[model samples]
Target: MERLEKSIVITLCNLEKIFPPSFFTIMIHLVVHLASEAKVAGPVHYRWMYPIERYLLTLKKYVRTRSHPEGSIAEKYLADKSMTFCSRFLHNVETKSNRTERYFDGYYGASTHTSLTKLEHGQVHRYIIFNLDIIEIFRNLHIEDLKQRYVYDMINHFHIIDISFSYLFNIYV
Candidate 1:
């Protein structure tokens, strides 16, 4: 700040014939106060403009129509906030959030065995890739050794695998 002030004063004192008096405008004067700005307002990032700019960008996304965009943004913002607040009190409300396995600590869903049955079977093109867990389950349930060997052969032969639904065993293999 002292360096900037020194430079500014030096430049003003040594104002050359090439530089016009109009160059010493209010904008130039404003640059001198920038050093003291952080003393008044914490930091540049934590200032009011940061959150305002973020909200402005969010509000800009709500504009579907070109006409009266501010009104549309305001309406959408209020509606979304109200719906989110209301969803907390409501039961069986479908909040379209992109989440898988909601709430880590709670026991909200069905049993582990029942949930496992709902998972898609791993596959590769026409060949199905059996899941390791399902194979373990099959071994416990006394699945044939020959069928297990066939599943292993399919896995070893084709490296590619995908999670898909299979109807043969009605299990996610």
Candidate 2:
């Protein structure tokens, strides 16, 4: 605003000879108040309507019908809020499901009994876990029963890669 005031004063002084004195009466006086506004309000952008503009943009997305935009946005907003409030108590409340199979819901592993030619003992291996959520649950329930089930499933289903840990926890817990 100080910069703005400086620019305005410089413009007025430079154009004093060319234009009539009456040309800089009302608007130029308004420009002079910008310096005082900076002292009171801190900055021009903060005092502006950016927050209201952003809120209006959010409301605009809820507008479906062109004929009655206000009604459309109001109804849609209320419906979404009500659904959000209601979904709190629901079980298996998946908001987004990009996968066809939710394999992470149960215990899963792979194993085989076929031995290589010269090995005296079975070769032990660790599975590469892809799902972090499954890994977290595995860490949380790292007790004897679930760990045993994991080993059993891995030995039984070595040829197949997928494993489900669902029922193992349900039975023990």
Candidate 3:
């Protein structure tokens, strides 16, 4: 039990370093891992995972501030796609277990209440297309270890970007 807690802390710290702006990402990853493990271990294991629940509250605060404002291209795009993905994922998961809502709430926070207007919607769709193009490059790869490799690659890429941006921001400001 001590070792498991230590491992979780270590993983969270490493994830924090890689994804500096969002502790929530680490929490979501933990929940995904826990959810998979809990299938066999059962609900009693969640007591040990209570830290994740605390993090979900923190995530809610973070997301409220981080939301892409109405009319922004990035906001529009992320909103639409996230809604669609959430809907489908929620449906699929709910069919298998009631725990799905708890996990979704932990990850996405509150759902958007309304749909975007046509002009805003158009901008979002364009952003989605651009994102899909980038994703497609990864989809085409035939590597056997792509899932694990992709996570490491993404972490490395984000680390570089974070360092580069911090250096540049400090120089200008």
Overall lDDT per candidate, in order of appearance: 0.58, 0.63, 0.54
lDDT rank, highest first?
2, 1, 3
How do the residues 1-173 of candidate 1 rate in per-residue lDDT, one tens digit apiece? Answer: 66765576667556644578877777766766776675677678776677888888998999877798878888999998997787766666556442336656766778665322322322232243244564555433433433455575654333322222233245644
CA RMSD per model (angstroms) = 18.6, 19.3, 25.4
- TM-scores, all candidates, are 0.33, 0.33, 0.17
lDDT of 2: 0.63
Better of 1 and 3 by lDDT: 1
Q: Higher TM-score: candidate 2 or 3? A: 2
**The CA-based lDDT of model 1 is what?**
0.58
Give the TM-score comparing model 3 with the true structure, all chains together: 0.17
Error of 2 at 64 (Å): 1.1
The stretch of ten residues in a row with the least summed lDDT in candidate 2 is 121-130
Which candidate model has the greater lDDT, 1 or 2?
2
